[model samples]
Target chain A: MDTFAKLQILSGAARYDVSCASSGSKREAPSCGTGNTSSSGICHSWADDGRCISLLKILLSNDCIYDCAYCVNRSTNPMERASFTAREVIEITLDFYRRNYIEGLFLSSAVMQSPDYTMESMVRVAEALRTEEQFGGYIHLKIIPGCSSELVRKAGLYADRISVNIELPSQASLQRLAPQKHKNAILEPMALIGREISTSLVERKVSRRAPQFAPAGQSTQMIIGASPENDFQILRLSQGLYKKMNLKRVYYSAYVPVTADNRLPVLASPPLLREHRLYQADWLLRFYGFSAEEILSEDAPHLDESFDPKTAWALRHPEFFPVEINRADFATLLRVPGIGVLSAKRIIAARRFSLITYEGMKKIGVVLKRAKYFITCSGRSFEKPDQPPALIRQQLLLSENREALVSAPSKQLVLPGFFA
Target chain B: MNQYLYDGTADGLLSAIAWILEEEPDPEKVMLRERMDTLFEEGFTIGTDATLAESLFFRLKQFAPDAAHTLYSFMLAEKEGMETSLLHYVSLAFKHGDQVKGYLTHPAVRDIVYIAKKAGRELHRMKGLLRFEKLRDGAYLAKMAPDYNIIHPLADYFSRRLRAQHWFIYDVKRRTAVRWNNGSLQFGTIEQFTTPAFSEDEKKVQALWQAFFKTIAIPERKNPRLQKSNMPMKYWKYLVEKQGE
Candidate 1:
């Protein structure tokens, strides 16, 4: 098949894995290099699904040896299969990069021949780009399971970021869908990468010339709604990964059904709303000073679809409400539903000059509609000071319903990616 | 009522602001403008005084070093009434000392920050959105018609990223080009510069990029409004994927 035909099949296969961040590392152009990675990644274009297309995300090959039930390119599935030679991939990436069409290349592949062999091919492409072509653009390489330790190490040297997908939420689900895959095969490489990244950091401190290893850090994705794992379970796993794996991000991909499978749940649509709520909870864990326990407890395993995770938490913990905007600290103000990181910082900064009034709060870009009940500006509350939590919930729900009607004429708006 | 006008440049504007603040003109009645007779024929248009501009620029650096970029980007905003708003902001800063950054809730300071944020956001987006094509002579050329006078910002950005290559980013609307020749960067205006013919290799790659762009769109969830919001249609004319329409 021709290059375009190979791209069609490979990129089509890769579309289901949706982690499009090309940020977090700062790689300047080498002496004669043609490109550089910016401190904050740039989105070259937005696809029709509203997802930011920051990289040329394509699979090296879609021809799989082991069948993963949730994947479109399963071994048993009947589909057109193709793979690109390393040179073709390099040419496409350089061409696209020179025209400023992508931030970099996100290269992945199936378990062709074997995991080690597939990984070697992917690493060869990255090595040639960095060493031979002197391409310094951001590269995100997917670590194939059961790959050799040496191959994995070499990938980190060239790639700005690397990820090994923990496809299913739990091991039991993995066994049922992809019996050939084992949890140890996935976690071993993750553990190895984590160790090398830490070692590289320590070595670089002693010697500034020491080569960096995946400077943007490692990230992984879990297929949501494919298994019976609840939101609470997912949050707990994400917390564990952040704490243990030293992960920069944990992507949540809402499972889109492509094949008829007995083990999977048949749904009319992808669980995009649930996926969005999980992302909000995920953001709370990463940015806001909220633990998985605080965001979702054993009693409430699921996030409320009508309200955001932050607002839901505020409603549940009414004692924290009515935080005085002028006197409240940054952490306290961050808990208020409408007060984001930016507005919270604004409040702290603006307060030094003068006391923030209700109008000032609005001018500072605080969303009073959601924050009014939770915050007080200059000791004046928008709602009654002694309002009941249940009543406040009802009022907020009514307003939210009205706003939904105004914003989404028919259905809920599906934002492109999670944990944006 | 007193009005002050200066040559439309960052240095000239800062110098004019310093002069107004030092003279203690009545803030309510005083207005500032670029050297545009069409907009303000009656206002006193101050000529570019390099000494005053340099002194004021240095003074600002000494006073609130962190806010120099903010002030410069705010001046780049092409919004109406922005000059007067920025003047009031600078006047307030001089009165309040370097602590002016803390007044985010203050009306004048808030307006300045908002304008700066808008300009900064556009510059960030254009870093990726700007497209370049190789010419017959192997020099790369790109064109932009940004809402703000962001050619300077784009030039500084690409200079660091494309140091080894010869390239130029031309602001078509402003009729100015920021060119990077090998390693050195020079900014100048060019009248009636024609678009160069694309090399054969460049044309082939452009076609491949267009094909990938076309195939990348997911038909299941086609949100044109979202697409337009992120990648505005105003920039579509220069893009290879959107060409030949």
Candidate 2:
């Protein structure tokens, strides 16, 4: 205890593990080590409610003997419990990575006095930040659930990424909300760290260069409006953790009720626009190809909070709309609704040198007032292309309420052109 | 006229887009002068003629040595009918040599890689939503000018989380500064600077990070139209912990 009171009791009990991404690690910056992984990972820094606080994220103790009722360091939440000593979390992550403040160490804890003594104090703080503070930065760690498989393979040889919070997406909402967590102790250590990071990338096993094992892979988190799950049973358990635990991300969060527990749901916050429309239908099922029963069903378990989720699946699949933007293809111009994936790779590289017209799909930016009544060009129809899909969803919800009353000239017109 | 001056830097716009792809000129007597004493009083100042810009930078490194530094940083961030879109992408990279990497999926080289990846995702979200406080002697300041070189990848994520803290940052559009302290990281040119005074516990942790950003903004998801489409009021004046309130 001390290292700023074990970083305010293990980052207030690892701020309920939201898995703030440092991102799919790449590792280069060791031509002569000191640190560097960033191929879009460690640079975080959000905290204004969007959270990510550029990694000092914390938790090597919250002294739990498991009383999980939506955890606030659960052994009946009175708070204040601390633990550090892995040389005070490697001298407060090398005095906050040598005083610039932080670029790594998210750690995590709570089993405390056992679960292999909290996975041998989180594998002796990633083997004392890789063999006595040679700390090549960006760590992440977490794996604890039923620990061993050789301490989740020595937490993927000094962690660049590793996660295991399946929390509550159903095993009957993890036995009525975290009943001392089990579902094969959180999916057999995430299927043994996804089969030891796919047999160390298909048997290219070169010992100590094992640093790439978790190269920013594995991500999990699910709480979302807690318990009675449904955004089609949490996107069919995120399409079986992205088709059987290859998992790069799952995250969600939302259920912020804090605690009063009569089996939860007395919510007054943390539906956060249904966890921001299930991270925009998990980015239209991982980059706008869309699946998980074409973005919801089971009597539509909630999502149309007016448009978006690819314009509510392009106004309920009006026979996959007018789609023509000079002969669509990159997955039908990424299913129209305000085309993105860099505007469908800029309308497949500006229709191979021109012929795209609706004024060249508004100079290749698209979003022609919601892809101009879906699309069609060289057969023009910026608007009326056989209307009546309920008057084209009431003239596209009345031009998104006249572009939300010409975008706030002093509030009032709440979401009208609902993201026109 | 043949009046060349170039030097606005990026190796003087890759030596005037390699002297109009080897001296074809006359796109109305091609004039792009940033200054070498802006020539032309009846022309003739071709002094960027670093041996005709190293023979069109060795014929664009023998026609695309993996896109010769991304076509010399998109011909020094080209604009204004960028020399007729760098002379029809160097005359379609000399008629499909190395199949001109399919003209980098051309729409004039993807509208300069979509304005340099939307100015490098607004300089990596203003280097993760820039918010620097703590002043009274414990100097840890911040200032931005991001619009993209995104201060060398946001100084490798703010020098590994302010490595033991004596910071600086400042870009204020390339007036530069990187600083850091004791652990080391230098870089210079912030010439006449000031904005320091803060400490009252850095304005009460910037009024508790703008009251936890107005208590997590869900006035029924009061979308300041989707929080100005993922935060953009030209990043509300250096987002000092979202001036919110």
Query: Which lDDT tens digits does candidate 1 get at residues A1-420?
Result: 988788878887888777788888889887787789886778887776766888898999988999888988899999998999999999999888877889899999988989999999999999999999999898999999899999999999999999999998899999998888899999999999999999999999999999999998999999889899889999999999989989988888788898899989998888877888888888889888899999888988988988889999999899887899999888998899977887888888888878889888887787789888887778798888868889989999999889777886322233333233
Measured with C-alpha atoms, the lDDT of residue B199 in candidate 1 is 73
Tens-digit per-residue lDDT, A214-285, candidate 2 = 767788787777677778878878878877878877877777666577877787656666776777788788
Per-candidate DockQ versus the true complex? 0.62, 0.03
Candidate 1: residue A256 Cα off by (Å): 0.6
RMSD after Cα superposition, model 2 = 21.3
Query: Clash pairs of candidate 1?
Result: none
As a TM-score, model 2 comes out at 0.36
Whole-structure CA lDDT of model 1: 0.84
Chain B TM-score of predicted candidate 2 relative to the true chain B: 0.36
Best by lDDT: 1
TM-score of each candidate structure, all chains considered together: 0.94, 0.36
The CAPRI classification for model 1 reads as medium
Instruction: Give the per-residue lDDT digits (tens) of candidate 1, residues B1-245.
Output: 78778888767776777777777557645889877768537777766677887887677767776566677777677666677878877766656666776687767788898888899888988998899999889888999888898888788888877777889899989899988986788999999989989777997788777777766666565677777777888888887777875
By TM-score, the best candidate is 1
